[model samples]
Target: MKDFIKFLRLDSLCGQLVAIAVLSLAALQCVNYYAVYSIQQSYASEFLSVGHDYLASVCQALAHMSAAEREDYLASLDRSRGALAKPFRFRAAEAPEWETETDYYKSVLAREAVTEILTRAGIPPRDVRARVLYGDSPEASEPHFAGYVFPMMQMLVQDGGGSWLELVQPLSVTDRRLIWRQRIFIMAESLICFALVIIFIVRAMLPLKRLGESVERFGANPETASPLPERGNYEVREVARSFNKMLARVQRNLTERDNMLEAMGHDLRTPLARVQLRLDSIEPPELREKFAANIEEIRSIVEQGLELARSLRTSEKAVPMDAAAFAASVADDMAANGGAVTFAEAADCGEPPLVAARPTCLRRAVENLACNALKYAGGAELSVERRGESVIIRVEDRGPGIPPELLEKVFEPYFRVEGSRSRGTGGTGLGLTIARNMVLLNNGFLTLENREGGGLRALITLPALKTAKIGEIRS
Candidate 1:
């Protein structure tokens, strides 16, 4: 039962199709069975009524017969009683417990028509036995000859400890024809109903299942610009409407918030710059030196703040570039900036297998990570290599690594590991955040781990560009 429920939850197109098909087929079978049952009941009742009328006509004639004529009638009833005849030739088979031939034929004969028919047919009592084979029990009634057989049916007597009414019910050729005809009708209707159900359910559920998947994908990446087809039933349309509205709202709010933060950072920088200029002109020997140093520190703080804010705004779109050359360029740029930066090794990565990315942003991200290592750990080991379908740029330093708990949290904005009481590092605590954002924008990832030897190792892996164009870019 648990496995069956799990199968129903499978969201594949084929699975959903099968589920709908099965449900539809079952419903059709139920409806078809009920319809055929109703038809059987109507026709069976008609058959019973006809049997009763036939008995009535024969009994009426027997009532006026003389005693000698009644003896001959009884003789005829006895001879025909054992004959095999089809009672209902044109009727279809009934499904319910009461809809069978034994019920209709036996019950109708037990009515007043049987005796009247026997007498009308010149049959007398003590001539023929009234044998009723009730589905509930089976026993033959006693035979009477040359006597009033009408009283035998009403005797209420028990034979073999069970009650029975005997009548001659011979099966005719028409009975066989009706049986075959009814069977074919019921089977044909059942098959047609099954087909209709499969068709209806498959058509309806196919789109709904696809729409559910589309909603999942949209939720996974709200920035995805691929639009879903606005087609299907009302419920699907309503769901799509809600999804699109929520997506638009999220995009709008994020855009507005980023714009506000960027604007504020830009506006505040000019005032900070003006304050620095005023402090530099102060000439008090002792007071001026302290004030100038404080003003310069404020300027640096403001610059870092603005840089952090700008990095948070994810505006970089990825493009193709040479991983080896990009890594080399970063190291050389730092070397030119008077930093002791050196590349441990470099190789072509991405595609077959030159990795593609936004060259400038990736270069800046690698440089920032290297800067962090050099600032705290005093120089670093930087290496670029292909790892499966990604380019892994690793920077390992010899200085102390962050605590284990703080490793993941370091990516959060302004999450400095050092306590407030300690002398803080020069960084504004946004370098890792910027690097992570850049990696994500390039369809890559950045992870930090404690080196076995000592210090921290930052690994950046970006998707390797596998297409022909990546090779061209690398060349």
Candidate 2:
């Protein structure tokens, strides 16, 4: 059942709509066929009812006539042409053969009606027998066309001389051509209905598809993503409008928060500077050193907090850059800043290792990782490689790795491992959080895992730009 649903693509709205339309059409066709067949049967019964008197008169004549006269009369009826000709046949037999069983209720009703007609013709009902015949019956040689079968009736009556009279007539005069025409008409109507239904469904769902795309883009980069257009039905337009309103509100809130953080940093830095200037009046050298260190820590916390806010709202445009060269530059910069960092050779690939990203933000994220590794593990090694459609930039170190349980918790804002909380470690606990945010801003992923021997590995995976060429590099 699962495989069948998958094959039909019933998980999607369009597939379900088409399936329902087809099923409804099938059911309608079945009902139409039954209705038409029932109507045809009703017409046949009415025809038999209207012709009962005429059939009784013929039976009366045959019962009284001699065998020779009856033969002449039947020959005259057969030889007559056009409107004068009767659409029935007569014959003489020694004994009558009546059908013992039949599946059609209409056939049983036809037999009973014919028996009543014979009784009215002065013939004994016990000596009269009747049966209904379809095209499949051996005694029925009725013409068939276009796979349609015709039905007929046969009746037998005993005469005074022990001879039997046989009569045959069509049950109904339905046109074979007419049945085909009706079927073709039904099929064409069903097809038109199905087409109209599909067109309406697709048009109705188009706006929803666009809305989903806009939502995904906004989630990836809300600062740059455009608002969804309010077009389509009333409900769809309303949804788009609501989403645009929410997006604007979120952007406004973010702007206000960033501005507040910037103002706080500015307001707190001036007072801290005044305090640092006044620290020399403490007299004792050790106490003076402690006061200065505490002031510096406070300054560091303010700067890191501002940095975290800024990372959330970067406006830098992304461009294609070689991932290998990018990693090399970051490693070089970190080393020049007196941090032990090494750049490893790029992995061999047929094409240039390019990725689309905001260069400044990506650099900041990688620098944060390298700096963290340097502070705790004393050194860091950076490497770049292309893995399928993604470019990986890894910063690894050889130090006591984080506890397995705290790996993900370390990425939260202001979260620190047990030993790294002291001022000597020199972290405001926002470095990893800010770094992850910066990477996410450029549609990249940042993850931390424990190294095999004893260390932590920070991996950044960015989507590789296959369309970028070496000539397109812009420093």
Candidate 3:
């Protein structure tokens, strides 16, 4: 049922409006029809009563008249029939023939209304009119009779002089035509009014469209400020104000969290530095070296945690750098320092890409992967690839790979693979976590996985940008 309603467009604003308009039009038609029908019925009843009364008046006058006077009265009645009343029509019957004088009176008095009146006067019409009149010489013709009855009498007039009367009440042509025209005009006006209302609603809803756009942008890029207009209808303005307040609260909370992490990492580093100094001052040479080594490793861990916090705090204002060349230089520097790190352009590379990033932060990320590989895998191969809208810097090695189950655990602070955090390995176990935090702060992602045959592969993907045109490059 929900799907059917969707297909019928019932959920949309425009569809609801059209449905309301249709129901209103149907209601209007019913009301118009009933009102017109009631008025016509009333007019018909009144006209019918008036016609019956007029018929009776004419019948009474004919009954009291002499033969010569009756002929004159019939002619006058026929003439006056045209003008009897408004919205009524009348017609007189033709003359009749009889074989005898008594037959004429009998036929005349035997008509429905005439017999009724004569019977009341103690006369039987059938006894008087006994003969049949064959009017034509060869062809037989039906006899005609005349009678008068008023509108109220509801009876007929019968006589040889003027026989049949027709009284009719028909709807006026002018009134009927006007009624039809009015219905047509109402329909036309309704359609036009409905169209106007729809247009007004759409225009009024424009502000809501803009508010929706603002909401989507706020969700998409929370770090950027987009102030919503506190204007338009009351509901719209209220929504805008609420959205702005929410954005402000989210930004403040995030900022405060980053600051707290930075402060804790900074305060811890001072004590760690003091401990490293004390370890160096131990009396026994071999024991002092071992103790010094332990304290320095602890200090390195502290520094890496501080770096991660700082990366998050500074990424929003980080300076831009050429990401491709920067990655290559880090690899070359590690190799020069006696680490087995090799740098090469990818087969699918283009001119170096630029990125909105901190050079020091990005360099630290690539350096951490190289050092991790040199420590465990003995060497690593580094390359930069330019993908659509992104730069992918990969560091791959050939050594015992990290266990599949522990792949994600390696990036957690102070986490190391089982048996890989030995003092002989000389690692603080915070390198990969720091690298990942830096990558994330720069609006990128860093992934770690085993290469096809053996060893770990770390790939950092950053949003790609075009290299600056000549003068646009910063020194």
**Candidate maximizing TM-score:** 2
How much lDDT does candidate 3 score? Answer: 0.64
Candidate 1's C-alpha lDDT? 0.60
Report per-prediction Cα RMSD to one decimal: 10.8, 7.0, 14.2
What TM-score quantifies how close candidate 2 is to the native fold? 0.68
- In the range 358-437, model 1's lDDT, one tens digit per residue, is 66667767878998888887787778787776778888888888888888989877677785312256666778887876
lDDT string, candidate 2, 1-475, tens digits: 6633443477777578778877887799889878877877677667666555555666677777887987787566545522343445555555855552367665566557767777766686546556676777765453421222346566666666676666666676555687778778778887898778767776777787788878887886576557888999999999999999999998888789889998999899999999998998997999999999889889999999889889987778888888889899888887888989999997578877789899999999999999889988999999998988898999999978899998899998888887754346888789999898888887887999999999999999998887734346444
Model 3 poorest ten-residue lDDT run: 146-155
Residue 149, candidate 1: C-alpha displacement in angstroms: 50
What local lDDT does model 1 show for residue 413? 73
- Each prediction's whole-model lDDT (CA): 0.60, 0.78, 0.64
Comparison by TM-score, 2 against 3, better one: 2
Q: What is the TM-score of each candidate against the true structure?
A: 0.52, 0.68, 0.47
Task: Please give the range of 10 consecutive residues that has the lowest summed lDDT in model 2.
Answer: 141-150
Q: Between candidates 1 and 2, which one is better according to TM-score? A: 2
